[model samples]
Target chain A: MTKPDVLITGSYPEWDMQPMQEAFTVHELAADASATSLPRDVADKITALAMKGHAPIDGAYMDALPNLKMIANFGVGYDAIDVEAADARGIAVTNTPDVLSDDVADLAVAMLIAQARDMMGAEAWVRSGNWGTQGAYPLKQKVSGSRIGIIGLGRIGHEIASRLAAFKCEIGYSSRSRKETPGWQYFDDHVALADWADHVVIALAGGPGTAGLVSKQVIEAIGPRGILVNISRGSTVDEPALLDALESGRLGGAGLDVFENEPKIDPRFLKLKNAVLQPHQASATAETRQDMGALQRENLLSFYAKKPLQTPVNKTGKSYPR
Target chain B: MTKPDVLITGSYPEWDMQPMQEAFTVHELAADASATSLPRDVADKITALAMKGHAPIDGAYMDALPNLKMIANFGVGYDAIDVEAADARGIAVTNTPDVLSDDVADLAVAMLIAQARDMMGAEAWVRSGNWGTQGAYPLKQKVSGSRIGIIGLGRIGHEIASRLAAFKCEIGYSSRSRKETPGWQYFDDHVALADWADHVVIALAGGPGTAGLVSKQVIEAIGPRGILVNISRGSTVDEPALLDALESGRLGGAGLDVFENEPKIDPRFLKLKNAVLQPHQASATAETRQDMGALQRENLLSFYAKKPLQTPVNKTGKSYPR
Candidate 1:
């Protein structure tokens, strides 16, 4: 049997790419490819889109590939891919979840501790010969037993909360509904959670519903003694307010993995000593990325075999032609 | 009822100093003060010593202070102070313990994840505009579920192990005797522990018995895929071997907070990209430092009132004059 045509819309590691090439007739697009970037001849042959990165896959992009049956996203978040649009057109969207949750949670906890303990600055003190000439590094805050607020009690958030619980932290969370987690305080209001926590972590899913979920008031509530960590999406926060809070000392500090217009993030963030900035590599680990690739490939293979989609996100009934 | 004469042999925070000044006839000495450095007249009146930092308190120094009755150390590790000489001279030695365990353990775990994730390098990538110009940061190792070996399952090591359990890491430890810890595997030998673990953390007390405990053979056993973290004392590991391993990639990487001849640490360490260096700051947090200071002061206050030392290290019975 001939390999099915697969359109790859983002950069993937060679480990994923090499196997993908062997299994399918793969067509490549730049990670930053727009709807117009796809060649008309190639788009017609593409039946499946293997997606990665945060490049938008909207209705127009979907319309470009007429025979498109499925879109398998590399990471858990599919906000960049307009899922509602796909569902309306009776197309299926599948994301590689669970596999990347551990890596993301690890980075979230890492950033929280890194910001609290000033790991970056402490390392700088060691490297600059300041530790010898200037004596001990300036004392920073402690992490263990601090009151921590998790903004979303989803898969990743639950992992983060569980890990921090071992640190003897008081875990408080704000979710759509109260979870069954024992010993965790549930807050319906984000501002209240921020007000009570020494450190606040955002693990909310990104999309229109959560855009600006962490507002100016939330930032203010996480006051000067409170640290804010975002490992979710840049769109989940009001960047202008966050930058203002960080700059004015209204917020203690931030350990940010995602940012608004990231890569081209607000230049102001670069200037703040209180911000620990990461370039959206939260789930970017060798072990986890490989797993994510495997899962994405598995979903694509499942669709091809007419087996139930491995991890379906939307109900696109009878959309895939048998 | 005059206040007893007390000599302070190191730099202490103002919070500790102000109280010491108010309670006793406080005498100041440089943190690097030696036996010969002490003025004969000032030493003659000193009945107790309040210590901080890693300054040596030898028998010769004790001989200089003829009336010295007690030495209150401001940190958990009293390796710098000659405890044997203090024992022979019947000087009550007290060290601040338990107070700084959380902070030290927090840093130990922080360094482990930081090294694994290349957090320092990641931040630099963001700051250098490489995140914008160069694309996603390179994938790094995963921390969660990794095998970890704790060199000493004492107060601080137990804290580290407990915290790591939340990350779902497999915990193994090497201590003088098997502890009451249920899920943790115990190894009697250091090399075996290193061989078994993806990360080896040295949490042993910094004294003669434990000096060079993480030897060259152990470093080699950790091998090219394992990380070594030292939050204990500089003397606990053979620094030359550690340096050689890191330089040669005989070991995967290291997260070191202490080093031989630190401050003046080996220049080779600064050149390596694989290692994460901290300036002996495992217990250097504002909250913990304040607690340590308070505990040290409490011990000193107990000695002045003819009470038992709060955290005595040696048996110097009936030596302190009532």
Candidate 2:
């Protein structure tokens, strides 16, 4: 019998896929290809699929691959994948989470500090030789002792709070339920959180449930002197509302690691001086990506060996214990 | 009886000099006049003087100002002033040192994290829309768990170490004397410190003693993967050697807040993408500057009250150990 073929749709450390390649015949997609552009004929021969956040693994794609048995996602968020359809077809879907929490948390704090201090602006000022004429630029805001509000207190949010605690920030959070954590104050509504917070972070998962959670009311509540940081999915925020707040100076600044239409960011955001923009790379650190790749490889190997797969996303959809 | 008039050669917070004006008849100099070009008769009437770092308070000016009593320097590192001449004439000199320590430490850490993560480069890349063409950029070095070497573990150095402790970076130091501290390793020489550390920070004091401390040998020891951060005086580093190291890739990256001929930075440094340059603004925060102004005013008030000054420059000309 021909060995079961696996199709990998995302980039990972080459060594991580070596073990999976040894176990089965593998076809790797070009790093730049969109999900729809992958060769359709090859899809029929695929027994397992491997992918990252960018690829949409919906029911339509699942229908094309009749022999597909399982999917091992490279990172935590599976919002791009249609899990309900995969579940209906008895396809085991696994995601790599928890391994990237600390790395993303670090990036969130770095972005917050960078925005508060006007680091990018300062660098440009110095490089342009403005310092020679102006002597030294004016000072920026203080990061420590600022009031920080977290929108969602999930794994990554909690990690960010833990790191920020060391900086002496007052941590407040808005979540579905109140947490009994030591230093975190819980608020049930986003407006209340924004009204009190000097810095607001959107860390909610992206999906229909969380779409447009940060409305114009919340942005207005944050006020001028307040900074917004988004490391979570772009759909969680109202982009036009955020842009309006920034333009009107109702919001002091923003540090964005993700966008509503990613890879095609809103052009209006480029004109704002108080914004710090990054290419959705919160969890793109070498160590975190390596860990994610290793976990994804393990999930693929475990399924082939007829063992219980770790970090199953289909289980979450079924309301099973994760 | 004639009143002893005070002369201010540089700009100050209006409030800072109001108290001084009430105490003594104050004379303000033209803002743009070169210190060397001040009228001879105006210089003759000046008794107590207030000045910023850029003004040349040298031996020639000291000789010209016959009635000069005290030189209340506005900021730390009074390298522009001729301290030895002032000491010889029994003219007391004071600087706002400790007041700026925390602010400078904040910038040092900011620069360290910014440079290590290629934050400025990444920001520019995103703003220019190059990110879409370049999928995900490769990771720079990690800040956590990296070995950091600090030269001259004075107040600013200590504060930086304490702040970085939260990030879990292993701290090492090279100073004039060995000091005992938990989790801090002391190296007698900078070369050994550079050999052991992946990141080297120059926080040593300026003046003749520390001139040329970070020689070519030290730069070479801190091999290709090493990052260098200079928050200390620019004279401490040999810029030509640093440029050579950067060109040869012997040094990984650098974040420089001060330079050898500041305001006239070496044009070569401007051409490098790996270096993050600032206009000597380690203590440029508004809160820190306000504290410094208040401290300078207190020191002046104490001197007039015939009490010991708060931060008098030592007889040997060092500003430490207030």
Candidate 3:
């Protein structure tokens, strides 16, 4: 039997491919290639595609890949890929989810603490030699016992909530539907949750459905002395409106791992000292990245061997069924 | 009768002095004067000296102030004030201890987490635009659920232990004498404690007595996977030896709030990415600092009234004598 041809379109640490090479006939895509950048000839023959976070495998690219059997995403959040387009082509979609929950949650909390206490600003103050002549400046904001609101109750969101419980924060959440969980108070409305929470965290799914879900009204409800953290999709928030809230101090601070434009973040955000900006690195820890790569390879091998895929994207509902 | 003269040696925030001024004849010393830098002429007439952290009140200064009845310290450690000499002269000394415990403990945990995860380095990577091209690097060390060794289990140490308990960390400690605390394993020796702990924190008091408590042997025992956090006093750890450990990567990372020759940290420390350096600001939050200033002023007034000081240094025993 001919080995399944897998086109891997993400840069991984060199050691990551050792396992991939052992399992399949792997084709290395150009380091900078988006899903659209694949050559026409290669797209026609590719049996599987492995994608990274930056690449967008939209409808146009899905239509071009005639032989693609599966798109094994290297991380959680398949927003970059049009799962509906793949579904129309009868191609399976898989994501590495549970493996990254702890790591992403770690970064989320790290960013929250870093932003809340102005850790970065404090470090800079000391390094700038102003600390010696001046005593420490007034404290920033407090983190312990603050009211925290989570927007989405998925695997990663639940992990963040569990970790935050140790800090004595009151945890409140808003999901599409509520399920009973100890220590978590569910809110039926996101805007109402913002009004009551001191820190509003965006951890919802990334798709057209969730796009702009956290609107200007929700941000205004967060009011002053409130913080916003986004570890989920950037599109879930209205970036320009959020910026206005920050400028006016309607929101206290933000720890954003995802941005509307991501690698090309709003330049205005650079001017805001209260914002802790990251390059969409919620699951970027070494252990988690390696695990994500390994999981992707496992998904591919399982599909080839006629075994069940571990984490399919379209588990309960049809992807964009119309 | 004329009100007793109170000399404020350390600068208190304007708001901190309102209550004290309403009750005493206050002489404001220059806010920026270091203990050693106070003019001899000004020192001659001081009836009571109000000092803050690390403001040296040595024998020479005390001898100059013939009318000095008390030295009221603003924060916990009075290493700069010679307590033994003050006691010999019947000059009372007091500090604000328990009030700053929670705030200082909060900072200790923040520094520990920041150092273990290389937060400073990660933030710099993102801000410098290197993260997009380089991707996220391996975190320096682990903090959660790790074996944590604490030296000096006093109020602040106990506070840190309570906070760490919530994180599920295994707690081990070495103090002057073994004390019974639930869930805490006491080690008779520092080296033995270091050998077993993934992170070693120095929360011991500062003075001639603890100048070099954490020596090379103890640091070596901590090994390559170990982290060291010092929020107590810079004199507790041998700075030269710590620099060597970090240079060789024998110790994973360090989060320091105090230094042996503070405001003059070893330049070698600046070169290391694993070190999270803060300018001795453990109790530097606004609320804590204000509380400390107010407490110091209150202690001075109490001395004027021939009343007992609130938080006197324990020169003779395990606990402060009333």
Give me the runs in candidate 3 sitting further than 4 Å from their true place.
Answer: A30-47, A88-90, A179-184, A316-322, B1-4, B30-48, B59-70, B89-91, B131-145, B161-169, B177-185, B297-310, B315-322
Q: Per-candidate DockQ versus the true complex?
A: 0.83, 0.44, 0.34
Candidate 3 residue lDDT tens string, B189-286: 99999998989888899988988899988998898877898999888888889999999998878888787666766667767877788877677666
* Tens-place lDDT digits, model 3, residues A1-322: 6667788876767767887777777887763565456677777778788877655777777676778878888888988878777777778888999887765776677788777767778777667776766666556666667788999999888877876776667999999999677759999999989988988888898988999999999998988777898999889999999999998898888988888866656777778888888767667666667778888887888777767787778632123122
Q: Tell me the tens digit of each residue's lDDT in model 1 across A191-225.
A: 99999998999999999999999999999999998
Clashes of each: 0, 0, 0
Interface RMSD of each: 0.9, 1.9, 2.8
Better of 2 and 3 by lDDT: 2
lDDT of each candidate versus the true structure: 0.89, 0.80, 0.77
Backbone clashes in model 1, listed as residue pairs: none
Residue A216 shift from truth in candidate 3, angstroms: 2.4
Which one wins by DockQ: 1 or 2? 1
- Model 3 chain B: lowest-lDDT 10 consecutive positions: B313-322
Query: Better model by DockQ, 2 or 3?
Result: 2
lDDT by residue (B13-78, candidate 1, tens digit) is 788888888899999888786756777888889988888878788999899899998998989999
The value of fnat for model 3 is 0.23
